[model samples]
Target: MKVLIAMDSFKGSLSSKQGSEAIAAGIKEVYPSADTKMLPLADGGEGTVEALVEATKGTLFTVPVIGPLQEKIEATYGVLGDHRTVVIEVAAACGLPLIREEQRNPLIATTFGVGELINDAIERGYRDFIIGLGGSATNDGGVGMLQALGFQFQDRHGKEIELGGQSLKDIRRIDAENVSPALSEAQFNVACDVTNPLYGETGAAYIFGPQKGATPEMVEELDQGLRNFARIASEDLGKDIQNPPGAGAAGGLGAAFIGFLQGELKSGIELILESVKMEEQIKGVDIVVTGEGKLDGQTSMGKTASGVAQLAKKMGVPAIALAGSITEEAADLNEIGITSYFSILTKPMTLNEAIDPDTARQNLQVTTAQLFRLIKAFKQ
Candidate 1:
């Protein structure tokens, strides 16, 4: 029998590759001679580069860039399949993790490092780019990113605007003439999960700013900032960028790329699955296993497991999802071809203890073994 193991990072616990391996281990125990394929998955977010690196034979490059608060950090991106495609995770330098609990402040955060990473790739003659936009710590609507790519944002008084989301309120002039001409020569795909528009009640600021350390006033301010930027982009750049689906991602960085860079916004799961040729590998596989760190209402929304199940349904394959925790809404997944769901935690345990990932992995392996035995019995 053949089996495919695909999974997303068990965030704070195990990586996507590790999760897939554990699932494969369990199935192989039941059919020791089974053919197993492991594919690590990410939704164009935090573990994107790592997932792609683990799945594809690829090399990673590190470049020095400015962090969220202007600190120096070495952000890494990947060259996949003979360096023809570049994979980048925006969170490496400017993500929320770079900011401490005490220092979380969307008003002052920036995405400059993300731009620098792209610029570095451009300099290396990479014209095809895959950008995963997740785990951002800013609400600057990509102004910080634009700045790094040679676009200037100036106040009405003709002064250069200062950095951070707070500065967007200053009446502004946008200058894009010096912007990297190389961008036009390249193709960019943004891996994103959210479908929120650029501005409104469901927009970037109101929905995501709070987690990035924004207060009520800051969310209001940042939302206005994104709207203002979109106004200019529509009028000056001839692009109607605001309110585009997924434009609220990465704190309005989605709008920034969609407007300024003309990047393509695509679901992270779709892009990753296509890039890795996951569908081709799943053909004729007896069973497929996919999982993530958590399963909840949000999991159905362009998540790794959801993507896999959708594909499995298309291929007429039975699939199972394993997670650290399975929420009530996960039941909807069964309709998409996920046969069942499993939670790795065996007993009531603390988050840390439940996430004692090695134990959880072993449990998943054992569970799969039993599940396979049941399948064999039924077939007999």
Candidate 2:
């Protein structure tokens, strides 16, 4: 029998590759002659660079860049096996975790490091880009990033505006004349999962600003700043970018990508799956196994497991999910493509015990063995 195992990371316990290997070990215990293929999976978020790099045997590069609050920091990016595509996660540069709780102020944060990473990759001759837009620490309408890339946002006095959200209202001109010339030859496929617009009630500032340490008053100021930036961009750049589905993602970085770079925003899961060419990897597999740290209603909403199961279903393959924990809402996953779902725990334990890497590995192997044992018996 042939099995394809593709599992997302189990959070702090196991990585996607390790989780798939554990499942493969279990299947081997049941049928020593079985063939299994392991594929690591992620949904274009925290683990995206690691997952894609591992899956494609890519190389990782680290560079020094400016952080959200003008501090210097080290950031990492990846080059896929193809050698032409570069993957960058916004979180690496200016994520919320980079700052202390008391210092989380969106108005003063910046995404300048993100543009620096992209510029570095371009210098290396990489023209294809897959950018993950998650866990940002800014609401500057991407002005900082644009500035780093040589897109000048100038005040009425013809001087470049200062960086960060607080400076958005001072912009009276947008200039791309000095942009990195190589940028025009590049293509960006942005991984964005949210649909918030650039500025209003459901937009970047009103919805995500508070989470970045904005008070009620700060949120209002940031929203107005975004509105001003959008209007100026429309008049100067000839693009109305504030109303797109994902324009608010990564605190208006999404708008910058769309308006200036001509990037396409897509579902995170969909983008990652396409990047990995998952359908080609699953062909002729007898059964597919996929899961994550947890399975719940949210798992059905374009997460890694749901994305895998949906593809397997379209190819006439049965998909089984194995997770660390399963909630009542996980039952809804059955309607999507999961033939069945199983929790890897065998007995009650503390959260710490459950997440122990060795313990989780053993449970995954044992559970997989038992399930395959039944399948073998029925086949006979």
Candidate 3:
């Protein structure tokens, strides 16, 4: 029998690759002669760079860049096995976790480090870019990034505006004359999952500002700043950036990519699956196994597991999910493509115990072995 094992990171426990390995071990215990292919998967979020790097046998590079609060930090990016495509997760530099809870002010956050990452990759001769837009701590309309890339946002007096979301309202001009010339030769595929517009009740500021430490008053202020930036971009750059489905993602960085970088926004799962050539790998596998740390209603909403299962279903293969925990809402996943699901826990345990790497690994292996044993018995 042939099996394909693909798993997302188990959060505090196992990484995608590690989870896949544990599943593979279990399957081997039950079907020693079984052929299994292990793959690492991730949605275009926090673990994106690591997952894609492992999946494609890519190399990782670390660089020092400015953080959300204008502090210096080290961030990592990846170059795929092809040596052409570079993957960057915005969270690496300006993510919420980079700052303390008390310091989570979206008003002063910046994505300057994201731009610096791109610039560094470009200098390294990479022209193909996959930018993962998730977990950002900024609401600066991406002006901070644009500034790092040599796009000038100037005040009425022709002086450059300061960085951060708070400075969006001071822009009187947009200039692209000094942008990195190599940027024109680059192609950007942005992984964006949300569809919030740039400004409004459901937009970037109003929707995500609070999570980034904005109070109600700050949300309104940030919203107006985004509106002003949008208007200025429209007038000076000839781009209507505020209305796109994902323009509000990562605090308006989506708009910046769309308007200035000529980026194509796509579903995060779709982008990652394509990058890893998932469909091609699933072709002749007898069964596909996939899962994440948790399976909930959101799992079916463009998550890694759902993406894998849907593809397997289309190809006439059964897809089973194994998760650390399963919620009642996850039952709906059956309607999508998950043929069956299992939780890897053997007995009740505290959250800390459940997340212990060795414990989780053992659970995954034992659970997988038992499931495959039943399958083998039925086949006989």
Best by lDDT: 3
Alpha-carbon shift of residue 163 in model 1 (angstroms): 1.7
Which 10 consecutive positions of candidate 2 have the poorest summed lDDT?
236-245
**Clash count for each candidate, listed in order shown:** 0, 0, 0
Candidate 1: residue 335 lDDT (0-100) = 82
User: Which lDDT values do the candidates have, in the order given?
Assistant: 0.86, 0.93, 0.94
Model 2, residue 104: C-alpha shift (Å): 1.4
Clashing pairs in 2: none
- Name the top TM-score candidate: 3
lDDT of 1 by residue, 99-148 (tens): 88889988889898988998999998998889898899998888898899
lDDT by residue for model 3 (1-380), tens: 99999888999899999999999999999889999998898899989999999888999999999999999999999999889999999999899889999989988999999999999999999999999999999999899999999999999899999889998988889999999789999999999989999999999999999999999999999999999999999999899999988999999999999989999999999999999999999999999999999999899999999999999989999999999999999999998899999999999999999999999999999999999999999999
Q: Candidate 1, 151: how far from true, in Å?
A: 1.2
TM per model? 0.94, 0.96, 0.97
